[model samples]
Target: MDSIEPRNIPLTPGVYLFKDAGGHIIYVGKAKVLRKRLASYFRPDKTLTPKTRAMVRMAVSVDTLSTTSEKEALLLEASLIKKHRPRYNIVLRDDKQYILFKLTKRHEWPRLTLTRKVVRDGSAYFGPYTSAQAARDTWKAIQRVFLLRRCSDTAFRNRVRPCLYHHMGQCLGPCCLPVDNARYRAMVGKVELLLNGRSSELLELLQQQMLDASEALEFEKAAELRDQIAAIRRTVEKQAAVLGSERDMDVLGVAETSKGLALGVLFVRGGVLLDGRNFFWSGLGLEEAPEMVLSFLGQYYGPQSVVPQRIVIPWALEEQAQDGSALPVMSDSLGLSDEEVLADSDDPLAALAEALSELRGSTVRIGPPRGDAENRLVTMAQTNAAEEARTSASANVEEILAAKLGMASLPHRIEAVDVSHTGGRDTRVGVVVFEDGKPAKDQYRTYAFTDEESGGDDYGVLAAWMRRRLESGPPWPDLLLVDGGRGQLGAVMSVLEEAGCGQLFAVAAIAKARSEDSNRADRRKGGVADSIFLPGRMNPVSMRAGSPELLYLQLIRDAVHDYSLRRHRKARAGSALAGELQRIEGIGPSLAKVLWEHFSSIRDMADASEAELAALPGIGPAKARRIRSGLAAMRTKA
Candidate 1:
């Protein structure tokens, strides 16, 4: 495959996908010079890391997409990684982007909200904070300090008066009345500033206001200001440290070992380190540490959100350009200028040499960090990196499942399907998608049973719905979960074969718990145990009912069932209404619905003359007379 050819590849920026013999994508990468970068792999370079060597050997074909720029490539890479999650790529196992605050601004008054889910509607969003607890705490702090409401938009708009939050002084009532937009905007600005680490500036302004109020003998107002000031001070003081004048800088520190590498990036904002995250790159060696860390930083910090005014690194690498805000790479030499250290540090030849030596599992001694401050930064980085690697190495649910099941990669994007019906009346199928081990409700789909009878046709219903889904233009999943055993699996296989998508997706089935000693209902006491069935497998895989994976699967199945049931009820109700009206001889659902909407009460229909009924759009003279006669005759008989 390597000898096949490397001709006619574009030199533009883009993400490249490398696949193995089995057509599974093994590696994904973004490159500035796609042709040049890809050509290097086919070159006769004998020295490559064990990981890269394995990736290269598996690489039967390479695919590329042209992006506008490197930044575009980076974004495309992240998105592709999210979609396919190639095996030899670094996967962010945890969903760090879930911690968002959704402010229900469509209300009469804007409210503070903290949520892990975000829909890309017109609503205001405040974060991708690392921690849910942190987001909640900040939300509470905003409510206390800013006095914003916390009610849903529906409740907020319809409220006749302020609620308990207002009486408790946690909200500035805007539902029943109006607040100046400028004032509210000012409060929002202050909250933004506080969140963005301009707390000191906000504190100084509040202090000045408090002093002014005191001088004016507005003691009550002054007291409130004092309390707010105190609260802000307490919040900031909890995480305080004396950062010497380096206002906006990012500290890059790395910890390397024989097995892998861990990189810690500390983002310092306005003289305070706001947050730091540790990343683990498995199977990387120590000599390759500098280049690996450099590559990761260029990719990770290159995103707009984390780019700081200055970047402080333990060492520099090839691709970094010279800038005034770039800090010196720490070294043993005492007498050196920052610019010279930076220029000398970023030599690409050194990085390549390091990468070669790194494959042999040998430790290369770099310069020692100077001063306690520098050492502390390095220590924090090392500690965090080690802990992060340890945490990742430990027993993760997805990892365990993948290893045990011999799957291609971690089963993150799981999909579950279920059917619901009410005895030959209303039937439907539910399709739900789960991402990063949680429900992504926006991707949920439903299919009404149009091809089969409402009930007693489980296999037929399943096959029809599966055919519809295969025809639908949604992305194929990593794993498909069905809420039944072999019968259901067989039904779906027929659909897959008919639709010609047999090799496009993986399939699994979850069977309901059966009783060995007890009846089905009695088995419900400890909750229904479930057995997962894989395609072509005779025996089902047993899992504890309350385990995270099983529970997650159950939740998806239940969601589908619930959605299907809801649709079934609606369909049954509509069908019953249609049946009742059909007894009138000429009226079907469309005409019955028209008469029902135009004249809500039967008495109103009975009172209408033939001319009046004929004036209705769908009702002609004949139908109008029939309606009038039917109503009158029924009333007379009664």
Candidate 2:
């Protein structure tokens, strides 16, 4: 390791990286002034924490990336930390985007749908709901009240008859019915108002509309409006109101325990507690709180993330002096003029707010709690964070498994793999991930295999998956659990050994229990306990039937089993659709694929008009007529 010269570092604002002997970056930090910050790290009188001292000893060199302003440095630091995943940085591991209610208002008959990703495709996104079930419940309520279109664009364009929802009066069936544009647009406006948390205004409008309908002797319409008003009221009442005025903001709280530090965020929309999220980092202390808060804010509220009008924190957003040393006073040796030093001293908090405001396309205020209501919200957030920390400390399922199963380390990130197929057709491999004893659904993946690749065998499927997994590389699982016995475990180990990754992670397999006498799987409840097989082990590991470790593995296995089966069925259905389409005259493999891409089901294709068919690439009027006739003839025969 070599000492970094403070004189050589720039006095300008920038981000710095500390690299170890192997040239691997272990830490990343941003600074108001690079020279002062780097000097803080190397000062002899400064009292460094054990972690900081260890990092400095391991570092061989430091690299600086200069930026025009503190804001630019902040953005660059977050980006580099995310890309390189430096060891010392507080990396937010959850990459899953929040659920949003997307209203496709650009369509003639707009529909509301749930999505995890947001795009600029003329759709209005309402939420970054932490709970998917809550978003779906709201969406369902809107659909019930508004009777907006429930079908997708393709389904709406191709349908010749109304769906069951239209018959049940849950939808207007704009797909098949001649609905008035003004009426539908009015309903859409009401939905937008409701989703925007302007429920009071919407209720007033609905009440006035109901009165007008009653005055006009339109009793049915009046009754419908009355029901709609009631439903909206119920939904609003379910949300606990914490303020008199409609204010949308997020409150941050911090909790520190002997185990770790936890940060909690409470989302308040229109003065109501919408939801809350908790993040915990074991072994982190209050001393690291400033860095944690900044890093979390930068990573969590990224581009496409929802930014509220205001953000309330438990404390001031001020930088802490590193290693008990005050910021270095500007000196001639540091190579900075007075004007340059003044320019670099811009407030970090203000810069952060400006960056967030730019992302939100509006002003974003960041500060401590302003009043009693906000203080209460922050207190609640802190309570939640503390409770989360307590719960996390109590739940040591991974540690228990590591000890019981003789694993080398705690399997914090476990992935279970299962292969699904029907009689060696449409083989698919599903992978489910568990992080810290809970499902990380966003990391779950499914891989499809053809007969040529997998040879219609479980071993072949596992091998193919292993090769692909190797190519994808790192963030590799701590434990790989397969849904089979010794043979499956052997197959996975062989592939990993061949690729020189056998020791990279532990491997195991699960097998259903069989009746000892009959040698058949018992159907009765608690008839037999399942068995687990470890790599290079001759027999199953013996354990109680309902032990937590066994049950946890079973839970992961069941998830992958269900996931893989669903994917296999979906593949088969797609194959059936393609087969049916290719049966039509003047349609081949390419044309069938194109048709499938446009229409999800054969019924949609059958219901499509000749003009629609002709509009498809490689299909002109003559072929369109031929294909339409062929489909009609096939329908008649069926």
For all predicted structures, in order, the TM-scores are 0.65, 0.81
TM-score of 2: 0.81
List runs of model 1 lying over 4 Å from the truth: 2-5, 21-25, 67-72, 93-128, 148-168, 174-193, 245-268, 275-382, 388-396, 408-413, 421-456, 460-478, 493-506, 516-529, 542-638
lDDT of 2 by residue, 226-309 (tens): 999999998777678787778889899998877778889988877777788888776677877877887888878877677888
Model 2 lDDT on a 0 to 1 scale? 0.81
For model 1, how does the per-residue alpha-carbon lDDT over 401-494 read when each residue is reduced to its tens digit? 5554557656666778888776755677778777655567667777776534545689888887787776664345667888787999999987
Which pairs of residues clash in candidate 2, taking residues 3 or more apart in a chain or in different chains?
none
Query: In candidate 1, which residue pairs get closer than 3 Å at backbone N, Cα or C atoms, i.e. clash?
Result: 424-455
lDDT over C-alpha atoms for residue 521 of model 1: 26
